[model samples]
Target: MNGDWLLRGRDGRLTVYLKSDDAVLCRAELAPGGPWEPFRRIGGDLGLQQGPAAVGQGDDGYAHLVSWRQAGTGESRLVHSTHFRPLLAPLDWSPVGHPNGRGDRTGTPAVAVDDRRRAYVFVRNAGGGVSLLVQKERGGWYPWRDLKGSSIQDQLAAASRESGLVEVYAATPERILHWRQEEPGRTPTRDETADVAARPGTLRALRTSAERTTLFFTDQGGELCAWRPGGKPVPLLQAAGPGPVAAVRCEIDGHDCTVLAQRSASGRVAFAAYPTEQEQAGAWWTESGPPLPPAAEIALAVDAHGTLVAATLDPTDATLRVTRRKAEAGLALEGWREV
Candidate 1:
C-alpha cells in the first residue's frame, strides 16, 4: 500500500487523497464525467500536526472529518471537522480512548464510521496492545476493546447504512477475521474466518446489494484475494514481480461485478470481475493492459442505477484516469488510453 491515500465518506460522497503528507484535510474529488480535481485543503489549515485522518457523513447529512495532530511533546490531538470546519478548538486526543492516555508509538492511528454516524478508532491501546474504540454518535470515546490477535498489520471497518450492521475486518496471527454486528444494539460477532497464506491486510468491503457482500484483501504474499460470502474466494491478478496489490471496487453490472487492481512496483493494473449468483460460480478474472505503468491510487463509485465510475492513477503519465461502463457492454473495456 502507498500509505499516502486516506479514505473519507460524507453525505454518501467519498473523497480520498493521493498526497496528504503535507496538506491538512487534504482531499481530491472525482467529479462525475469530469477529470479529478487537484488536491485542495478542504478543511481549514491545521497547524503542525497534519495527518492520521478519516472522513464520513453524519445522520444529519453533513460531512465530517477527524484528524490526529501531533503535539510538541510527542502527544496527539484529535481534531474533528464538521462540514469542512474544525469544531471545539481541537480536542486533545492524546489517549487511544481518552485525552489523558497514550497509544501506539510508531503507527498512525486509524478511524472509521458506522451507519448511525458513529466513529470507531483502531489503535494500540494504553496497555501496549492494539485494539478498537467506539466513538458514539454523540461524540464520546468508549473503552478500548482488544482485538482478537496481537499484530494488526492493517485494520478496516465499515457500517452499512442499509443493513445497520457494522463490519470490521482485521488480520491476526491465525487468519483473516471478519466481524459483523449480529443484531441492532449488540456487539459484533465473528461471522467468518479465512486462512491467509499472506498475513492478509489492506481489506476493502462493498455491500453492493442487501444479499451480496464482497471483501478485497492483500495477503502476506502481496497478492489480492476477493472473498464473496457463500462463494469461493477469487484471487485477483497480481502484477508480475514483487509488490503489494491495490484493488478497488468499480461497479456492479447485473450479475457481474468489476474491480481494478494495480501492481504498485510495476504500475500494472488489471480490471477484474466476478459473476453473481445468477451467473456461474467460479474464480474468473480478466485483465485490460499489458501490465503497464502504475498509478498513484484507485477510487470507484457506482451510481444508483448500477453505473460504474472508476477514478484511478493513469499509468502512461501518472495522471488521473476515469472510465464509465454500462450494463450492456459486458464490461469488456476498450480504448482505455491515457486521456
Candidate 2:
C-alpha cells in the first residue's frame, strides 16, 4: 500500500489493508497501537496490482476501499467494498461490486471523501486517461466518468478540504497535472505545473488546509521535490535509493507540515519534515532518522491524535511492522515499537 492506506475510523480505531500471499488482508486497531483484531481475508483468488486505497469513517460511519483485480491473463478491473461498522466484532463488509465495468487495465485507485461525505475514486485507465466515480450522499455509486489525459506515469493522489473542494494529481513523462472540482456538481478545472523528469515514481498530494495543497514526487535525478499549486518545484532531499516515497500531512511542535519517509538503497528508512511555511531556508528540513531494518517500501499515516505511524515489511521475515511517533518526540527514531 502506498499513499494514505491507513485510515482512522470511529473511536480513534485505525484500519489498514495489505496484500498478503493470496488475499487482501485487513486488520484494525482499537486505537493507534494496541490490541489489533485478527486479520480478516476480504478478497481472495485474486491478483492485486497495488494494495487497497481507502476513505475512512465517513459521516455514515463506513470505511470504503478500492483496488484493482487482475485476472490470470494480466487484465485488471476495479472493485470496491465497504465496512458498515469498523469498530465492532463480526466485522460486516458490503458485497464487492465492480464499479468500473470489466476488462480495463487500471492502476491503483485513489479515494477521497469531501465535507458533504460524498466519496470519489480516481484511477488511470489503460489508455492513460483518468476515470472517476462518485458515491452519492444517499447511497450507491455512479458510472465511471472519463477525465481525459495521456501518458500518466503512475497512480493518482487525491485530497479534499472541508470546503468540499477536491484536488487530484498525476504525473506524465514531461509534466504533472492538477485537477480541481470546486464543489460536487460543478465542472472540474485542469492545469499543468512545471515540467518534471520523465521517470516513474509516486505522485502524492496533501491538502494541508483549505487554501493550499503540496505535491511530492521523485524527479529525474531521484531527488525528492515539492511543488505548490503555482510555484516552482523545490528539491527537498537527495535520493537515497530507487523506490516509492510516502508522505502524509502532520503537525510537529506548533507547526503544521508534511512528513516524508523513504527507504535508502541499503534498506534503511529516513524521514524529514517540510513546514507549511518556513522563516529560514535551511531550517525547513529536520535531520534524517537513523537507519532501520532493510525495507523495500514504507507507508505513512497519522493517527487521530496526530501520532505518526510508519509501516514496512521486515526484509528477513516479510511480516508487516508498524511504529508510532508522537508529536512531542520530534524527529527521533528511538520510540518505534512493532505493532
Candidate 3:
C-alpha cells in the first residue's frame, strides 16, 4: 500500500513527498494564489525507489533530496540529488557518495538540512543497527559513523536548522535510543535506553518552540505515548477503547494552538486540540470535533506560522486530496487541482 506522508522544511518553502505508482518521488511547491505545479519525478537507478527525503532548499532555490539505491553488487547506496529547481526537471539526478550507511528494506530515510543546505541521513544498518551519516555543503559525503550499538526500527527522528538541537530517537525490539546533536559537526550526545519498551512503527518529533520538543511513539501494548526530555512519557491514548489508533499527528494552529490527528481502528479520524492552559509535558488532548474523510493514505504538516496542511488519497475515487485550515477557519479539503 502507498504510505502516508510527513513534512520537513527544505529552504523557506515546504517540500511535500508523495509515493507514486511510477516508482519516482513526486514533488510540488505550495504558494498562496500560485498554482499547485505539476509533480516532478525524482528517479532512482533501481527499478523502484526506497523513497526520498525533502531535506530542504539549498543555496539557490534548488531543492535537496536524499534517497537510497541498491547497488549492482547487492549493497545499499545512500544517494543525494544535486540542487533541483521546481518546474525545471533535472537533466539527470545522481547520488552523493562518501557519507554512506548500510541500507535496510527501501524504507524512507530520515533526513534534516541545516541553513547551509547540508544534509544528514540516519538509517538502520543491514544488521538492524542505527547509524548517522553527514554530507557537508559542496563537500563529499563523510564515512558512515555508528551512533548507537542497538538495532533500530525503521522509524528515526531528526531536526534541522531551525530545530535548535536535533534529536533522533530509534527503537530496538527491547529498548530505545535517543541521539542528540546539540550542534552540527559536534559529536552527537547519546542517551541510551531513554525508555525501555518496544515502540510501534517509527519515531516522530515535533518542535513546539526553540527549546521544546515532543516525541511520539506507540508502546508494545499499542498505546500511544508522548515523551519530552526532563519529563516522563505520558499516554496520549490507551488501546483499551473503541479501537487501536491507526495514525497520529501533531499540528500547531494560529496563536500557538496545538492539535493532534488520531486515526482510530474503526476508520474514524480524531482531531484532538490540546487545551491552551496545560503544559507541553503531558499527553493531554482535547477533541477538536470529528474525523477526516476516510482514505488509504494521509500526509500532514504545519507551516512555520502554524497553518495546518494535510493531503490524503481518496480510497473510492483514487484521487489526491489536499486540505488546509487556519486557526479559526474550518478545514479546507480540495483536490490537487484545487490547491
The numbered model that scores best in lDDT is 2
Which residue pairs in candidate 1 collide?
A: 95-101, 198-220, 199-220, 267-293, 267-294
Please, what are the lDDT tens digits per residue for candidate 2 over residues 115-212? 66776777777678787887777877766688888888657777775576677888888888888886666534686566876247567676666666
lDDT of 3 by residue, 1-339 (tens): 212243433333444455443334455555532345655566533343444343433334455555555665556555666445444454344555323333334344676555555666676665566666677667777677766555566666665325434566677787667777776576466854556574545355655556655665677777666676666776665532232222323444334544555554554344444533243444433233234454444555655455666555443444555556644544433333334
List candidate 2 segments past 4 Å from native. Answer: 43-62, 70-76, 89-101, 277-280, 283-295, 314-318, 326-329
Best by TM-score: 2
TM-score of each: 0.70, 0.82, 0.74
Q: Candidates 1 and 2: which is better by TM-score?
A: 2
Each prediction's whole-model lDDT (CA) = 0.48, 0.64, 0.52
- Cα lDDT tens digits, model 1, 1-339, are 122132333323334443355334333445323343444564455542433454444334344455556644766555554443112122222323333355323333454456666665554344434455666667566765665544555444343435555565655665666666656545666677777644433656555556455666666655566776556556664433343333334444444454544444445444556553222343333444444453345555553344655455532344555555644656654445443
Ranking by TM-score: 2, 3, 1
Q: lDDT of candidate 2 vs native?
A: 0.64
